[model samples]
Target chain A: MKRRTRKAFISLIIAIAAFAILAIELYPIAITVINGFRRDIVILSGQPFKLSQLTLRSYQMVLKNIGFQLGMKNSIIIGLLSTGISVLIGAMASYGIARFRFSWRNGLAYSFLVFRMLPQISLVIALYLMFSYVGIRDTIGGITLAHTSFNVPYVIWLLLPFFTAVDKAYEEAAMVDGCNRYGVFFRIFLPIVAPGLVVAAVFAFLNSWNEFLYALILTGVNAKTAPIAINGLLGGETLTWGQACAAGTLMLVPVFFFTLGMQKFLIRGITAGGVKG
Target chain B: MSSRKPDTDGVSVSLIKGKARHRAPFLFLLPALLVVFAVLIFPIVFSFFVSGFNWPLSEGAGTRKFVGLGNYLALSVDPEFWNSLKLQLGFIFIAIPIELLFGFAAALLLNREFFGARLVRSLLLLPVFFLPILSGMTWRFMLQPRYGPLNALLLKLGAPEITWLGRPVTAYAAIIVQDIWRMWPFMFMLLYAGLTSIPQELNEAAEIDGAGFWLKLRSITIPMLTPTIMTAVLLRIIDALRVFSEVYVMTEGGPGSSTTLFSLYTHRQAFGYQKVGMASAMAIFLLCISIAFALTLVRKNMSLDSLEEKAGGG
Candidate 1:
């Protein structure tokens, strides 16, 4: 009976802890969404947790801002372009590293890992100067290129194991049947690794979309991304909580859903990177 | 084996084999190597070159003058730079252990079969997906002294309303808390991965031997989790050292420079003060620190692998 009571007490503790974890995780998101719908800043300030009358004024205000619209456009373009280019290049490189045994293969692979792990700040200044000199500093193309540089290595790393896991017999048979190396890669290998490519593309898109430092330093008025624009709202003299929260909610929408849909692959990807590195 | 290969095809086969062996790998690697070189390697080399000069953005690159070792020497005595380094160390040392502890506890709790486990795990990962800037801004608003929900809760509990982000201590604490909240989920996921990967037989055997929960955890669980723990710790330390967006959006390294992280300081020097050379030097210093940590991690990982092999084999 004593042991049963002890077991019951422990289970109770675990349940309570689990509930608290849920509350803590959901609180900020709930508050952000709630505050976005609120119109009166005074009420928001006074009773942040209280439910007030919901309205679309904040969203309307944010959507009406030209900078927010431009930022959204630039963010989407950069994210898509970078993810596409990074996945294409990363796939080829990972195929080479996985299938071909070259003298410098291990060295090249390690270097890519090191590059991926390096902090962006260490390299941003040089990139800024180089881009400026080349006359693409504030352009959408420039930011996309910068994002690709950081992301391709990550994509390559993530895709390498996936490619290595694929059977070589498929490629060998395709090659034996009069297909060239490129054709085999495009026809058989690419289709085989499509799931990994999807995961890589999703991660690359999210990384580029959420990047702030490069966008802040590399771009001016021309190609400011959503994070930077949202940050600008916060930096304004007046605290427009409703509008800011609305923008925040908008920025989070794609990523929140993407994460939920691809939770399995994302978890596996993260663990693979951590464990293998 | 029934059909012998044609001897006349030897020339064509050798030629094709030679071409494939010699060129395919390089061809495959060319595009990625070019991008990495242009965007990553070139910048690193250029940063090193520019670190020796007294360069400013206002002054064109042609007008820059060389100052050999000047920026490095200047940093040796710069109190602000030193303080930022200290703060980064403090942030990593304090926040990482707490994250690991809390994450481990959470992982342990959720490792058991339970109702809504999938839902809870997914919910826990939400913070990891939030944009760092947005997370920082939301936390900044929520920590407001007068109107923030936290202070409001405190007021209801009969405690005095404390200015959360206005004071140095509280401001630093707020940054740490924000970081812990944003990052503990990552550690939890990784540790939970580690926990789930452990062979159940070891724990079962321990249980058969009359081992209690604590004994099983210490003897069977933690030893097996060392590799995952090391990887998680290394990644977190490297990440924490380079923290910027959260601190930038929340504190801007304020409360009298109490929360100036290394990256934020480099940014201020380069952009705010327009001291490009000085900032480059700081960036190099940050690079050296990262390299040292990474090397230590590699060496430790090697040793740990050998140790684990022995433990398992014996």
Candidate 2:
């Protein structure tokens, strides 16, 4: 009975600590969500407002804002294009590095690792100049290309292990069954690593979706993304904190869902790179 | 023999022999290599060339004059450059340790079986998914002295309303706090995975010997987790060095350049001052620093056989 009580007390302490940490950790998000519905006047007043004062005014404004609409569209377009291209290219390259013996193989793998670590500022500076010279600067194509460059290395690194882990029997069996190498890769290897590919794709999308500095430099009005659009709210003549919050909340919609749904994959993807870094 | 699991070395040799007859691997790698060369390699090479010139955005690309090593020399002597370097190092040194500690604690807390633990874990990752720019904005809203909730709560506690982002020190702290808030989940996730990957039998055996929690953690958990911890810290350090969007959105390295970090400083040099040459030089410098870190990571951890086997085992 005494031991049971001690266990209960310890668990109680742990529960309390978890609650406090969760509250602190989730406070900024909570405020963002709450302020999205509150009136700007109430938000700016810096005082507690009644729950009854909540309204859809901020969401209404954000939805009506043309910049938000355009930015959201461009972000989605860039995210999908970049993710698709990178996943395909990265998967192919990773498979080669995994399955084949070639000179410069390890060298290429290390290059990707190093490339993955290259600062966005460093690469984007050069990209901005190069894109401008090529007359693609500030266009969606330009930004998409830039996103793809960085995403490829990350996708390769993320998917390398998945490719390497497939058993040699699968390939030999496929070969015996009259499957060409490409056929084996396309049909067998892909299906086996489909789950890993999904994780890599999701991460690649997220990186492109939430990307800021590259977008900030490589894009202007036409290719601006949601984050940049929301940031513009701050620089406007009237600071619309409520609307910014609403936009931020909207931007988080995909991330929120992805986080909940892909919890395991997200954790795995994050750790995989670090473990092998 | 065909029914048995083929050894990796034998498979590798067969693949190598097969590779001599077919160009499949090369063909598979060609597109990606081409794209990488065009998009990544070319720009890096171009940047190096441009860094030697007196290139300015205002002066069209055609009219730039060569001033070999000038921009690098300027950066070496620039006080602002040193200040930004100091700030970047400070941010890394200060933020990473706090993040490591808090994240480790959070991981420990959540590592156990508890009701609603899965839901809590999912919720904890919310910050990691937040767009960094929006994170900066959200924190900016919360740190607003006039209208922020934090100051309101402080005032309720009979404390002075702090202009969180108005002053240099507080502004810097505000960014650090925001970073800790945004990043602790990452460390938690990594460490949690590390914690889980630790062999359960080891801990059970230690417990059988009557070791306490701290002792078990010290002896069985931490020593085993050293690689993960090192990897996590180094990854965070590299990321902290590259930080821009959050700081840009929050302080814009403002309150008189106090929060100006490496990336932001490079950005200011390039776009703000239109010093393309100088910014290119700075970028190269940053790249070299990053390469040093990357080399350390690769040299310390990489063994091709181990990497391959680890993947196969998983």
Q: Which prediction has the highest DockQ against the true structure?
A: 2
Model number with the top lDDT: 2
lDDT of every model, 2 decimals: 0.82, 0.84
Worst 10 residues of 1 chain B by lDDT: B1-10
Candidate 1 chain A lDDT trough over 10 residues, lowest sum: A268-277
For each candidate, the DockQ is 0.47, 0.52
What are the per-residue Cα lDDT tens digits for candidate 2 across A1-277?
9998998787777777777778888888888888899998888888744455899999999999999999999999999999999999999988887887665677777787778888888888889988888999999999999999888988888887677777777887778788888888899899999988998999899899889998999899899988889889887778898899898889888887777888767765654454652
lDDT of 2 by residue, B215-285 (tens): 99899888988888898898888788799999999989999999999999999988888888999999999
Q: Write the per-residue lDDT of candidate 1 for residues A1-277, one digit (tens) a residue.
A: 9998998787677777787888977787778878888875653566866776779998999999988889999999999999999999999998887766555765676566567777889989999999999999999999999999989888887786567667666877777788888998899889999989998988889989989999999999999998888988888888888888899899889888789989877665553343542
Interface RMSD of each: 9.2, 6.1
Please identify model 2 stretches exceeding 4 Å from their true place. A48-50, B1-21, B60-63, B311-314
In angstroms, the error of model 1 at A44 is: 3.7
